[model samples]
Target: MPPKPKKKCCSDKPACKRCPLQMMKKGTLPPGYTVKKRKLVKVKKSDKKSKVAA
Candidate 1:
């Protein structure tokens, strides 16, 4: 398995080591990992969604 990706990106022009964007480009991101708002987020295993109360 590959090294865990960085939780946050340095936002550098060249992308820092373990940067999520860089890992994505390199196709080394682990399962359930995704980049959101320039940060790496792990998808909830429960897949639960907030319910709006009527």
Candidate 2:
């Protein structure tokens, strides 16, 4: 457990501005992320025969 000291080379300067994947690859992706597109309602084989005849 003694082999961890080689992480400071994002062009070696200013500590790479505290890299978090280089600020999400320079896109700054971490502020209430959202991409919503939900609309799933598939269940209509005539309502499955009235829910199997109750």
Candidate 3:
């Protein structure tokens, strides 16, 4: 069995205090805080093509 995946801090607000990405960007992460890896989102070419057609 695979190990359990880590929980991601998925806040959309800018400079979210609880978000790991924001904490890492600000260099204010608390001691022993483990940063979770972020998943990459795939963009659909159809959406871009439709926008270009408009």
Best by lDDT: 1
Candidate 2 TM-score, true structure as reference: 0.15
Model 3 is weakest, by summed lDDT over 10 consecutive residues, at 39-48
Residue 17, candidate 1: C-alpha displacement in angstroms: 2.6
- Candidate 1 structure, TM-score to reference: 0.66
lDDT per residue (tens digit) for residues 9-45 in model 1: 8888776768999898888889888999989998778
Cα error of candidate 2 at position 46, Å: 51
lDDT of each: 0.85, 0.36, 0.49
Ranked candidates (lDDT, high to low): 1, 3, 2
- Kindly report which residue stretches of model 3 are placed more than 4 angstroms away from their true locations once superposed: 1-7, 11-15, 39-54
| TM-score pick, better of 1 and 3 | 1
Write model 3 residue lDDT over 1-54, tens digit each, in one string: 322222466767663455666655666554445464553223334534344554
State residue 12's C-alpha deviation in candidate 1, in Å.
2.3
Per-residue alpha-carbon lDDT of model 2 for 1-54, expressed as tens digits?
A: 222222332445464444444543455534433222221122333434444654
How displaced is residue 18 in candidate 3, in Å? 1.6
**Which runs in model 2 stand beyond 4 Å of their true positions?**
1-21, 32-54
Residue 34 displacement in candidate 1 (angstroms): 0.3
